[model samples]
Target: MCIAVFLWQAHPLYPLFLLRNRDEYPSRPTEPVAWWDNGEILGGRDGLAGGTWLACSRSGKIAFVTNVAEVGKVPEPKSRGDLPVRFLESKKNPTEFAEEVVMEAHQYNGFNLILVDLSSKSMIYVTNRPKDEKALVSEVPPGIHVLSTASLDTPWPKAVRLRTNFEKFLEKHGSGELPAEEMADKLMTDATKADKTMLPGIYSVEFEHSLSSIFVEANTDQGRYGTRSISAVSVKTSGEVAFYEKYLEEESWIEHTASYVMEQTGTG
Candidate 1:
């Protein structure tokens, strides 16, 4: 996912509210949110890598991955998508799992991963970006946070706007049982409401228009690039989970919805 804003324990009624936008070439193949045959995990699948950028286990575990934007970084053999899938498959607490991943983080391209354990109301964020001070397991503080094709909370224009808008969304709609459609609209915006002078620094000239907006669409010589999918997830304290997704197919966004009750397998 390119841009994501997750509210952990920020709402009184909902413990988790996650909104993310995955950007890629329009031709890239992907499947909308759905449970695998085993019916334990739920999220859209990356057809090319057979992994997922974001997913939630029935036990209230959540994982999210985002690429680090930089130049001349060597690509790793392991796909970043595997990070989320692997976390969902493991039973380790977020701290243990994040620390273990840091040991082998060099094996993958630069990435930022968020692992959450709802049973214990804990979250861990880890990244392998050389620019960061050092790799370590850090707890995700309560309240609003943003992640994009950069370090976590990097304050990229889109990230800042989304975070601000998300807070306003919650404040206007109230913290209780949020309107998923309104939440989805908060992410569907194409407005690039940022200072023009800061554009070149935030994004390359070619990708400025595309990457500046919360919802992107930049057609350049490189390829037809834009936001491919928008997903909104709300997990209630009572274990009622609601997931809504819209995938850009051709020229329109096809919508899909799913509801699952989180089964407390065990405490993290």
Candidate 2:
């Protein structure tokens, strides 16, 4: 599971400021944030699926995904991680790409995919969860929003916590350059668990409580499972983008940063 809080077109200095926590088993092989061999995309890579949970293109496209917290999962469903990679690789805008996903949405387990194009100031949220209803595709408004294991901005305990803290930080920083590393340390590393009454009922109370924190850590029979990486992406109005990640590697935490300027589309 993953959770991300992003401010889209809400800040004057930054068109998009996003922070994400990728939660998974500690043993999973992962590559930290870096430019791909193609010299375009920038983000971490999932070693098992060769896909990414959050990534952006040099062309100013950004995408990230999170799993839905449902119990009755489809057996051997298509890999949801591929959603972000495909969107980044495609020429389609947010709406077009999301529409395509809706067609085969059922083939994958429940997911919440967010597609963003900084050049066009477009952000789309797509989800194929709550299987009883149609897959949802909607444009995300300009504001601070959290995408958790549930739908976007569903007010899960952690989501609300992140949003509230993030708002205070933004207000304090006051439109200047945000401290990406400091923000990650203060906001993404929080281990406060939600009260039992606030835990989502999709999973067992204990299991859901374990994941209630913004930074999740739990001991499971399979091994240690928790947030493996924290990523912060800040894109300035001048086209400069900074991507930073603090990730666990070989039982130690390492940090990396990649900086680039978005290619001007000249349309926006």
Backbone clash numbers for all candidates listed: 0, 0
RMSD of 2: 1.6
Candidate-wise lDDT, in order:
0.81, 0.89
251, model 2: CA deviation in Å? 1.6
Best by lDDT: 2
Instruction: Give TM per candidate.
Output: 0.92, 0.96
lDDT of 1 at 1: 27
Model 1 scores a C-alpha lDDT of: 0.81
Alpha carbon lDDT of residue 54, candidate 1?
Answer: 85
Relative to the unseen true structure, what is the C-alpha lDDT of residue 57 in candidate 1, on a scale of 0 to 100?
91
Top TM-score model: 2
Model 1: lDDT of residue 77:
58
Off by over 4 Å in 1: 130-134, 200-203, 265-268
Candidate 2 per-residue lDDT, tens place, 122-175, comes to 999999874347448989999999999988898889999999999999999897
Point out the worst 10-residue segment of candidate 2 by lDDT: 129-138
> So what's the TM-score on candidate 2?
0.96
